[model samples]
Target: MAVFRSRFARVLAVIGLAAAMLVGVFVGTASACSCLPGGEGAKYARATHVFTGVVVGRALLSGDPDTAHDDKYRYLVLNYRNHKGSAPALVGVETAVGGATCGIELALWSSYVVFAQGDASDGVVETTLCSGTRLASGGPPVTEEPPTTTTPRPTALGGSSPACPPIA
Candidate 1:
């Protein structure tokens, strides 16, 4: 009877372990951001703004110090194609802090080929990881030259020589 009980305990332990692993897999999938099947051409076709630019500044809108879904990032436009209208010298793009919600965190001073969807006239553009935005290193060759000199932009930040547009 003791031997039978010990074997039963081991079997139960193995079953519990398997169940925990299965639950973990499901939980991981639940937290992951899923995207529809599409390539660059499809992403570009759906984008309202496509540009190569450097992230000059960023601001936390709300939520914890980590970030909210709509943190604003300012970019100095280098080469771009604005489907809505003429492209501006600088633009604001909003996304979450990271990829949990399919949002992308653009590093300050880093260049990216941003495939975004928003009206440039409003002074703010928005994008996500699903938008197909990627590092400039792997993007198309820049045909036009970037700005030779930088201009000071306004921001809500204090004591800054260069800044982004004030938070609205």
Candidate 2:
């Protein structure tokens, strides 16, 4: 009886440890792509084009010459103005399409400020998840607006910058 009790206790302890480890792996922890925290100036400098636009179209690009599919590249069509590069009313850009891939997620008709690089080989623009392509703030359109009194801004302590900078 004593030996049986001892063995049971050891097994219970091992099981408890395993359960805790498994919980640690799955509880409130998810893997995500690491992106650079780029300021507006830095992102603008790196990007070949920067503009506000709406994602109007998307399609999965074929990798194989024989119509095989690959998630590494997806094509996006955008309608934009405030011409930063050219005067194109519509343009296509390459992006990533899967969990393992790295590119901004775009929904149809969603507005965003896109930072991208132009691919000379295909004459297409390319953007990544980390390339500073971000959703436009809530407004009638994605266009810029003048500072409003309703806007919540951090008050300055003295004659310096805002006292409370926004958190990341």
Per TM-score, the best of the predicted structures is 1
lDDT, each prediction:
0.69, 0.65
In model 1, which range of ten residues has the least summed lDDT?
A: 141-150
By lDDT, the best candidate is 1
Pairs in clash, predicted candidate 1: 154-164
Candidate 1, position 71, lDDT? 46
The residue-by-residue lDDT of candidate 1 on 1-168, one tens digit each, is 999999999999999999999998877533457876667767776777777777777776665555335444444444454433344767877776568777787778788888888777877778887888888889663333344445666444644555445557
Worst 10 residues of 2 by lDDT: 139-148
What TM-score, over all chains together, does every model reach? Answer: 0.56, 0.54
In the range 1-168, model 2's lDDT, one tens digit per residue, is 999999999999999999999998887534456777645556766777777778787777656565322454544556455335652457677786654356567878888777778853454688887777777663222223344344455444534343354666
Cα lDDT for residue 23, candidate 1: 91
Off by over 4 Å in 2: 2-31, 61-70, 73-75, 87-89, 98-101, 120-123, 136-168
In model 2, the Cα lDDT at residue 16 comes to 100
